[model samples]
Target: MIVGEQKPIAEIKEMVAPYKKLLVLGCGTCVKTCFAGGEDETAVLASAIRLVSRKEGRTIEVEELTVERQCENEFIQEAAEAVGRNDSVLSLACGAGVQAIARRFVTKPVLPGVNTTFIGVLEKQGLFTEECSGCGNCELALFGAVCPVTRCAKKLLNGPCGGSQAGKCEVNPDTDCAWQMIIERLKILGQLDNLRAYVPPKNWNTSTSGGPRKLVREDHII
Candidate 1:
């Protein structure tokens, strides 16, 4: 899932300072699951903004709304009324969400309330770790599902680089060496032979090399 963290309140205050009527929009999908921008968070942020405005002798009206997603028009339409009523929108969603709202409401200012971190999974109740770089081309089958591209500090294809010590990464002892984990996983699956073949340099064209990416599903198109 896409993970993100809420931006500092001080910075949020500065951004919405010019707007007397502000809408705090939340995304109930990715950001919500990450505990960054859910319905509860949206309400809390709106209240905080109002409180700060009152304390500063500024009269700002803040409203809160949460949509299932801000990236798609289907969910975005739900917030149209609230957005139309506000002077500006403070999006508590991911960067993509902020941009999506901006693209739809071209005249209104859409400010990001959270910093998009990365594509990752929830490692634990309170911890989220990055696990993928979205390199376009997937090579997980070759490494026992452990991606060395993002996990390795050096991004080595055939690695254990001299720095792997006691199953820990040399650059950061706190981190488990990607190669070590890969080898251990392969050994368990009885697929250690997968690594014997040489892996050539990764193709850059499939990833960030060309700029923004898009996917079209011809079957889904009506």
Candidate 2:
């Protein structure tokens, strides 16, 4: 899942400082699951903004609302319609959500209220460790499902670098060596020989390139 966190209260206050009417928007999908831009978080942010505005003697009208999602254009359109009547929107979703809201409603300024963290899974309760860098390349089949691009201190395509010590990464003693984990996993899966296969240099152009990346699903278009 995509993980995110709310921005600092002071930064959020500055973003919507010029707007008199502010709509704090939340996402009920990934952001909700991550507990960053959920309904409760939205309420808290709205209250904080309201308090700050009151203290400043600013006539700011802040309201909170959540949509099923902010990534999709349909849902973003709904949110835009619901909050467009206001002066501006303070999006508590991820960066994508904030952009979506801004793109849909060109008139109102859609300010980001959260910081997009990473593409990861819950490692344990309350711990969301990054797993994927979204490098636009899939190397899981060769590495026994471990992604060295994100897990390794250095984005090494081959085996363990010489920097690893005592199964710990050289970059940080607290973190485990990503290559060690990969080797162990490959040994268990009986795919240790696959490690001998050389991986070509990644084509960064296919990933980030020069501008924003996009994927179009014709079947989904209606």
Candidate 3:
């Protein structure tokens, strides 16, 4: 999931201070799982902003609401209507969701309430680790389902980059070498031949194309 971290309360307040009526928008998906832009965090931020405004002798009106998803147009449209009634909106969703809300509601100014971190997975309870960089190219088949692009520090295609020592990455001794892990995994599965095949470098231009990328679904065509 796309992971994110909340900005400071002071920063959030500063961004929307000019607008007396501000809506604190929360997303109940990725942000919720990461504990950054969830309902509880939104409420706390709203309440804190209210307190700060009051202490500063400024009457700031802040309201909190969590949408099922901010990335969806339907949800964004509903939130847009709610935001239309307010002066501004502080979106507590990921960068994508924040942009979606902004696109759907071009009239109202949307301020981000969190810093979008990365594509990651929950390592354990209350711990999240970055796993993917969304590099556009996928090579899991060549690497035993392990992503060398993201896991390998050097992002080497056919690597264990000479620096790797004792199954650990040279960049960070604490970290395991992604290629090493892949080789070991392939060996265990008797698929060591998979590593013999060379995978080409990723075409980043197509991946990070300027502006939004679109996909068409013939079955879902309206």
Candidate 4:
């Protein structure tokens, strides 16, 4: 899932200070799981803004709403009436969600309330760790499902660089060496010979170097 963190309240205050009628829009999917911009978060933020405005002797009407998702048009459209009634929208979703809302409501100012972090998974309660870089091409089958591209500090294809020590990464002692983990996993799976064949240089063109990507499925298209 896409992981993100909520922006500072101070910064958020400054952004919405100019607007009298503000809408705090939340996403109930990814951001909800991370506790960044879910329904509860949206309400708390709205109340905070109102309290701040009251303390400042100013009146700011804040409304809270949470959609199933902000990235998809169908979910975003559900908030159309609420959005149209607000002076501006404070999006507490991922960067993609914020941009999607902005694109749909071209005339309204869409302010981001969260900083999109990375593609990752929940390691434990309240702890999310990045696991993928979305390089377009997936090479997990070659490395026993451990992605060296994301785990390796050097992004080495055939690694366990010379600096690795005690099964820990050279870049950060706290991090496990990607190659070490890969080798162990391969050994356990009886696929150690897979590393014997040298991997050629990766074709980065398939990645972001090609710019914004799109998937087209003729069979799925209606």
In candidate 3, which residue pairs get closer than 3 Å at backbone N, Cα or C atoms, i.e. clash?
none
Question: What TM value does model 1 have?
Answer: 0.96
lDDT of each: 0.94, 0.87, 0.87, 0.94
For residues 1-222, what per-residue lDDT tens digits would candidate 1 score against the true structure? 999999999999999999989999999999999999999899999999999999999999999999999999999999999999998999988999999999999999999999999999999998898899999999999999999999999999999799899999999898999999999999999999988989999997778886888889999999
lDDT of 2 by residue, 1-222 (tens): 889988899888888989988899999988888889999888888999999899988889888899889988877777755686799998988888888888888888889888999999988888888899887767788888989989997789886999998999998898889899999999999988988989888777646674578879999999
- Runs in model 3 lying further than 4 Å from the true structure: 209-212
Model 1 steric clash pairs: none
**Pairs of colliding residues, candidate 2:** none
Model 4 is weakest, by summed lDDT over 10 consecutive residues, at 197-206
- Residue 70 in candidate 3, Cα distance off native in Å: 0.4
**Model 2 segments beyond 4 Å from truth?**
none
TM-score of each: 0.96, 0.93, 0.90, 0.95
Give each model's clash number. 0, 0, 0, 0
Best by TM-score: 1
Q: Rank the candidate models, highest TM-score first.
A: 1, 4, 2, 3
